[model samples]
Each structure stands twice: as C-alpha cells, then as structure tokens.
Target: MEILTDYILQFGDLNKQQTDLIASKAKKLDLHKDDYFSEAGKIPKQVGFILEGVFRFCYYNNKGEEITNYFVEEGNFVVDYQKFHTQVIASEYIQAVTDCKILAFSRKDWEDILNTIVGWDKIEAKIYQKCMTQAIERRSPLVSEDATTRYLSFMEEFPKLINRIPLSYVASYLGITQQSLSRVRKNIR
Candidate 1:
C-alpha cells in the first residue's frame, strides 16, 4: 500500500526488493469499532501500522475500570511494544475505537526483515527511539502539570481528537472526570 510505503519512507529509504519483501510479510486486516487488536495477558505477536481510523491503548485497574493511556490515529503505529519485544503477556489492551484498516507484521517476520534488509535495522532503531520519546512525552505532563492544565494542553495538542474520541476516555487520559472535563471545556469557551 502507498500509505505503508510512505510511512516507511519517513524513516528511511527502501530498495524495491526490500520493499517487496516487506509487502509480502505485511498483512492487511480490518477491525470493527470496539474490536481488540491485542488484549491484556496475551502475547503480542504482531506490530500494526494504522492505515485508517483510531485505536486506544488501555488497561484495567484492580477495580476493573479501564484507564486510557494512548490514542493512535491514521498514519501512526499501534502495537504492544513491551509484549512484542519481550514475547510476554501484554499489560494493556489495544482496541479500535472506529472501523480500522491496519497493516500488521509478526515480530519474527520483522526481525527477519531487519536482518536481511540494508537500511531496515536503522529504521527499526529509529522507530524504537520515536516510541520511547512519545511515551516519555505523554507521561511528563501528567507528572508536572495540574489537571486543568493537562486537559487544556491535550485540547491544544489534539484538537481533532476532542471531537473524535469519547469525552470519558479523554477524561481518563487527562486524570479527570467527565463532569470535570465538561466544566473545564465550558470555562475555556
């Protein structure tokens, strides 16, 4: 797919043979809204790149309430990185929030690609760095900022997501309640 090619190109250039190899290993799958790409306690076998729609990464607490962590939309990668890398059970769940098209490659297949392809190893390293940076950035504000400020910052950073995702999940991600989020929105308006 052009989208997959474009995304890969963002990290590094790929030769025709390398690209064809990758294309052969990558599988396209459609997910319905609320369908899970990966669930807690399962070993994540594949890494997915979102070609369309949105996905939410969440975890359930001891109280059995889902705590939203990350949101990935089109052109973004969505995978349980810890589980995928370590071949262990995932601690969080990844679910599609809307109908989604995803390009998936198994961990072994990706590793094989990296070993054989000239630039693929560097691309994988860069992807890991990007993922780590994003993870840190996402957690930093919560530790350093107050709830209202966090909510405001989220609104500013992801203006479109405010309209796309449910307010409840957004509130959970911001460490606030739906009622509190409503108040914050009203005050800002």
Candidate 2:
C-alpha cells in the first residue's frame, strides 16, 4: 500500500525492488472493535502498521482490570517492541479500539528486510527511537498533572481521538474515573 511505502520512505531510501519485497511481505488484515491484535502472555507473531482506525496498548492489573496506557492510530506501527524483538511473550495487549485495517509482516519477513537491505537496521532503529520518544512525551504530563489538566493535555495532544474513541478509554488513560471525566468535561465546557 502507498501509505506503508510512504512511511518506510520517511525513515530511509528504498529502491523499487526493495519496496516490492516489502510489499510482498505485507498481509492486509481487518480487525473490528474489541479485537485483540496481540494478547497478553502470547508471543507476537507479526508486527503491523495501522492503515486505519485506532488501537490501545493495555494491560491487566493484579485484580484483572484492563488499564489502557497508550494508543496508536492510523499511520503508526503497533507492537510490544521489547517482547517482539526478543520473540518473547507479551505482558500487555494491543487491541483494536475501532474497526481497523492493518498491513502486517511476519517475523521472518521483517528479518529478511533487515538482512537484505543495506541500511535497514539504522532505519529501523530510528523509527523505534521516534516511537519511544513520542510515547515518553505523551506520558510525562500524566505524572505531574491533575485530572483536569491531564484530560486537557490529552484533548490537545490527541484531538482526533477525543470524539472517535470511547470515553472510558480516555478516562483510563487520564488516570481518572468515568464520573470524574464527565465532571471535568462539564466543568471545562
């Protein structure tokens, strides 16, 4: 898909042949809301680039309550990076928040690109660093900000997601209760 090729191009140069090799590895998939792209305690088989919709990075607490920590929308890659890289069982879940279209690559296929492409390792590292940096920046506000401020920052940072996803997820991400989120919303307006 053009979307995927364009994204890879942003990180590094690729010839037609290299790009075709990548395209050949991509398997298009559809995931409906509430579907798990990858589940907790299972080894991830493939990594994906979101072509449509949103996904949440979540984990269960000791009491078995699922808490959403991060979200990935269209045009981003979604994976439990450390686990995927080590080929280990993931401790968290990557779940679809809305109907989604994704371009996936199996582990072997991803390794093929790394081995075959001259500068792919560097390119991959850059992409990973960028993703990690963005995650850190998004989370920093939550550590020190109040509930209202956290919600406000969330709205500003992910303006597109505010109306697209369930408010419960927004509440979880903001570290507040749904009732509190509702109160904050009412007070803000």
Candidate 3:
C-alpha cells in the first residue's frame, strides 16, 4: 500500500485522508504462478497493483498460440481499461508469471475514489497517459525494427525483467520464435 501511495503521489498530491481512503479500499491478494488475475472472456471485477512478482498481458492468436503483449512488474498497474471502465468482457488475459502479491480494488471503489477525492481524475489522467506512452514504446519497435534490435530494446527498457521472466514469453513479446531469440542471445554473447 505504501508503494501504491508513493506511485500515485508521483503524479499528483493526495491529502492524508485521500491516501487513507485509497489504502482502505484496497485488499491484498496472493496469486500463485500460472494463475489468472483477469482471464479472457470475462469482465474484470478489480484493478490490480503489483506489489511483487510479474504478470503478462497475453491473448491467443488465430493460430491458437499465446502472444504476450507486455509485462507488468512490481510498482505498476494492470487493467484492461477498455474492458474495466466500459464493463465489457476482456479479449485478453492477465496472468501471473510467478507467485505474486497484489493490491486489488473493485471498480465500485475506484469510482468512489474518483467521485470523493479532489484532483483524482487529474491523477488518473496522468496515469493513463503514462500507460499509453508505455504501450507505444513497446509496440513501435515490432513494426520498425528487426527481431534482434527489438530484443536489444527490450533489454534496454526492462533490464531487470530479462532474467526474471521466461525467454519464451520474451520471444513472443518480441514477435520472434524461441529459437530465434536463442540465436539473438548467442550472437550478443
């Protein structure tokens, strides 16, 4: 909760009462490896803040292969805003990459915070902006760069995650096969 408070504080100032309200609304959840936080074809009830471990945003392609869209590590937020805010069923999945501890709050509580707290909308807007920027950074390389270059950029962007996450997931995220990723790694070495 302190980490979440600090993360939010980075974007906007929150009064003690507001911070307390946020902390009160959140609940801790432990997810084991391979557990799904939000699954495909379901409406997500809660927004999760990663307190520990990593998660991947993924979906099955037409070929029935799972494609990793991105990863969320500790000190980050993970919610499919289109589905969560619009109350629609999600087309993608959010799954724990490892055992994870998360702070979750229902959509109702999130709305309550938005309505009750002053300047929260501004803070949320900034958070969404950051999320958008990150999405762009993660996707743009796939369109313009070679697989090896994309892997290099991934290393640069997520230096801490390379060793923590599975290489298969990283290869999927880079739009390359696991063998290709191995070759890239070998070449780099």
Q: CA lDDT of each candidate?
A: 0.86, 0.92, 0.92
How does each model score on TM-score? 0.92, 0.97, 0.96
lDDT of 1 by residue, 1-189 (tens): 778777788789888888889888889999999999999989998899899898999998899988998888888788987778779999999999889999999888889887889878788778778877886787678767877898888877677788888888899888788899899888878
Angstrom error at residue 137, model 3: 1.2
Candidate 1: which pairs clash? Answer: none
Model 3 alpha-carbon drift over 4 Å, by segment: none
The C-alpha stretches of model 2 lying farther than 4 A from their native spots are none
- Candidate 3 residue pairs in clash (backbone atoms < 3 Å): none
Q: Which pairs clash inside model 2?
A: none
What's the true lDDT of residue 72 in model 1? 81
Query: Looking at candidate 3, what is the lDDT of residue 39?
Result: 91
Which of the two candidates, 1 or 2, achieves a greater lDDT against the reference? Answer: 2
lDDT by residue for model 3 (7-61), tens: 9999999999999999999999999998999999999888889999999999999
61 in model 1: Cα distance from truth in Å?
Answer: 1.7
Candidates 1 and 3 compared: the better one by lDDT is: 3
